[model samples]
Target: MFSYCADPSVLDGWWWFSCFLTSATHLDFYRAFGAVIALLLVTAPAALAMGMAGAMMLRSQIRPLSMLGRFYVNIVRGVPDIVFFLFVPIALGQGIEYLLHLVNCPDWDQPVRQGNDFLVCRDAKMPPVDAPAWVRNLYAFAMAILAFALVFGAFVANTLHGAMQAVPHAQIETAESYGMTRKQAFRRIVLPQMWLVALPGLSNIWQILIKATPLLFLLGIQDVVYWARELGAQKTSLYSYPHPDWRMWYFSILLVFYLLLTWASERGFSWLTRRLSHGQATAEGERLRRATA
Candidate 1:
C-alpha cells in the first residue's frame, strides 16, 4: 500500500516485509480472519439454541418427542463429524430445492434423481444461475452455519441433558412445594442450576467449535486456512512479490491465532463461570464468597 511498494523488485528489508504484508493476497488473508470470527459468533448461539431445544425434547414427557430427541442426540453423536460436515449441506440444499421444485414446477414430470445427477428446474435452483457472487457466497455460508449448528448442537444437547439431570431432584420438589408447576420449577430452579453444571462442557464445546472453523475450507468457503495456503505458497520471479515456501510460517501464524483464540475463550469462560457461580452452593461460589469476605 505504501508508495515505495510500487516496485517490489527494488524493495528490501522492512520495506519488502511491509509490501509483502500489504499485498492484495495478504490483505485477503487478513479478511479471512474476520470470516473465522464471524462463523464462531453466528454458529455458537445458533448451535446453543438448537441444543437447548434438543435437551428440552430429551426431557419431554411425550414419548414421541423424547424418542425424536434421543434419535437426534444419538445419531449425531455416533456419526463422524466430518461425515456430517460433508453430507448435511448437500442434503439440506437438495431438500430445499426439491421442496421448491414441487411448488414452482409442479407440472414438470422429470424425476429429480436421474441416475447419477440430482436435477432441479431452473426456477428452483438455489440463488439461481444468474445470481451475483455475493449471493452464492451467502448461500454457502448459511449452509455452513447450519452444518456447524447441527453437529455442535447434538454435543451440546448431550451436555445439557446431563446437566439438567444433575440438578437436585429436591430443588424441583421445593419449587413444587411452593405451588409451582413442573414447568415453573424447571424454569426457576432446574434451568438456572443446570448452567453451573454445564458450563465446563459447554466451554470445551466452544473450544472445539473454534478449532472446527477451519473445516469451512472443506465446505468451499475460502476461510483463513484456504487463504493461508494460497498466500503462503512459493512464488517465482514472474510474480511481483515472489517468495520461497512459506506454508510453515503461514500455518504458524494460524497456530498462534488459534492459541490466542483458545486463551481468550478460556479467560472469558472462567469469568462467566465465576459470574454464574455467584450465590450458588458450588465450590466456586463458596470460594468467591470467601474471597469477597
Candidate 2:
C-alpha cells in the first residue's frame, strides 16, 4: 500500500511483502479466519442442543424413543466422522433441493435421480443459479454447520448419557424417599451433579471440535483452509505479487492458530472444572476438603 509498492518491479524484501499482504485477496484471507471461528461458536451450541435432545430421548420412558436415541449414538459411533463429514452435506443438500423441486414443480418434473445424476428444476436449486456469491457461501456454511452438529451431537449424547447414569442413584432415591416425583428428582438432584461428571468428556470433545474445523474446506466453505490454499499457491512472476509454493508456511500458521485455540480452551475448561469440583462429592472435592482440614 506504500508509494514504493506502486512499482512492484522496484519493490524488494520487506517492501514487497508489505504490499502483497495488503492486497484485496489477502484481506479476504484474513477475514476468512473469522469464518472458521464463527463456525465453531455456532456449531458448539447447536451440537449441545442436539445432544441434549438426544440425551433426553435416551432417557425417555417410551421404549421406541429410547431405542432410537441409542441407535443414533451407536450406529454413528461405528462410522468414521470424516466419512460423515464428506457425505452428509452433499446428501442433505440434494435432499433439500429435491424436496423443493417436488413442491414447486410437481407437474413438470422428471425423476430427480436418473442413474447417478441428481437433477432438480432451476428454481429449486439452493440459492438458485442466479443468487449472489455471498448467498451461495452462506448456503455452504449452513450445510457444514449441520454436518458438524450432527456428528458431534452423537458423541455429546453418548457422553451425557453416561454422565447421567454415573450420577449417584442414591441421590435420586433419596429425593423419591422425600416424596419427589421422577421428574422432580431428575430436575432437583440428578441434573446438577451430572455436569461435573460430564465436564471432562465435554472438554475433550471441544478440543476435537476445534481440530475438526479445517474440514470446512472439504464442505465447500471459504474457510481458513480454503484461503490458505488460495494464498499459498505458487504465483508466477507475471503476477503483481509473485511467490513460490508457500503452502507449508501457510499451514504452519494454521497449526499455530489451532494450537492457541486448543490451549485457551483447555485452560478455560480446567478453570471451570476446578470451580465445579470445589464443593462436590467427587475426588477433587475430597482432595480440597482434606487439604483445607
Candidate 3:
C-alpha cells in the first residue's frame, strides 16, 4: 500500500487496487484459503481411518460384521455426495438432541415431532443456547468434517478392499507353506503389498478431498468460499473502497488458490510414489532398477 492510501480520494492508478485488495474482508478472504487447507488436513486422515475400519469389517469372517460393513460402503456409494452432505448433519444433529432430551427430561411427555418441526428442550440444544460464537462455528465445522469423512470413507473402503484382493495368490500361498494362519499371512504378505496398489487410488481420493473442501461453505462453515463470496459481492459506494461486480475476480483468486493446493499435493504424491516404490516387486520398482543400472 502507498502512503497516499491514508487519503482515499487521492488514490489513483495501482494504489487504489492495492488498497482494495488489502482490505480487512480481503484479509479474511486470504485466511479462508488456509481454512480450506485445514479442512483437508483433518478430513483426509479421518476418512482413511474410517475406511480402514470399514474394510476390515467387510473382510471379517463374522457374517453380521461383514454385512454391516458392506452395507455402509454400498449405501454411501449409491447416494450422491451433495445429498449426504446436506442430510447427514441435520440427521445427526436431531438424533443427538433427541437422545439428550430422553436422558435429561425423561418425565416430560412432550412429543419431539409435531408435524414439520423437531423440538428439544433448551437444555438439549447442542453447544447449548448460550454458547460462544466460536463454539457454534466449531460444531458446524465438526459436522461438515464428519459428513465429508463418511462420504469419502466409503470410496476409500472400496479401493482398499480391492487392493487387498489384488495381492498375489502365490504370495499368500507361499506364506501358507510356512504354516502361517490366515491372519498371519494377511498381516505379513497381503496387508503390506496392498499399499503399493492402493496408493494411486488413495492419491486420487486425496485430490477429491481437496476439491470437496469448498463444500464446507454449504454447511455454514466460514471457509474460503464463504469469505470469497462475502468479500467479492458488490460493495456499496459508502465503503472506503467501493467496487462493482468484483465477484468474478475474487473467485478467480480462489481458483488459483485451489490450483496451487492441488499442484503441491501432486508433487508430494509423486515423491511419495517414488519413495514407496523402491525395492518393491511392482513395475515402478523394476523401472527404478533399470534406471539405476
RMSD of each candidate relative to the true structure: 1.2, 1.7, 2.0
Q: Which segments of model 2 are wrong by more than 4 Å?
A: 1-4, 289-293
Per model, how many backbone clashes are there?
A: 0, 0, 0
Best prediction by lDDT? 1
Error of 1 at 157 (Å): 0.9
Name the candidate, 1 or 3, with the larger TM-score value.
1
**Residue 47 shift from truth in candidate 1, angstroms:** 0.6
Q: Global lDDT for candidate 3?
A: 0.87
Query: Lowest summed lDDT over 10 consecutive residues: which window, candidate 1?
Result: 234-243
* Per-candidate local distance difference test: 0.94, 0.89, 0.87
Considering lDDT, where higher is better, how would the candidates rank from best to worst? 1, 2, 3
Q: Native-vs-model 1 lDDT?
A: 0.94
Spell out the clash pairs found in candidate 1. none
Please write out the lDDT profile of model 3 over residues 164-253, one tens digit for every residue: 989999989999999999999999999888988999999999998888888888887888877777777877764457677777987898
User: In model 3, where do residues sit more than 4 Å from their true spots?
Assistant: 1-7
Tens-place lDDT per residue, model 2, 140-258, is: 88988999999999999989998999998888899999999999999999888899999999999999999999988887777788888888999886555888999999999999999
Order by TM-score, highest first: 1, 2, 3
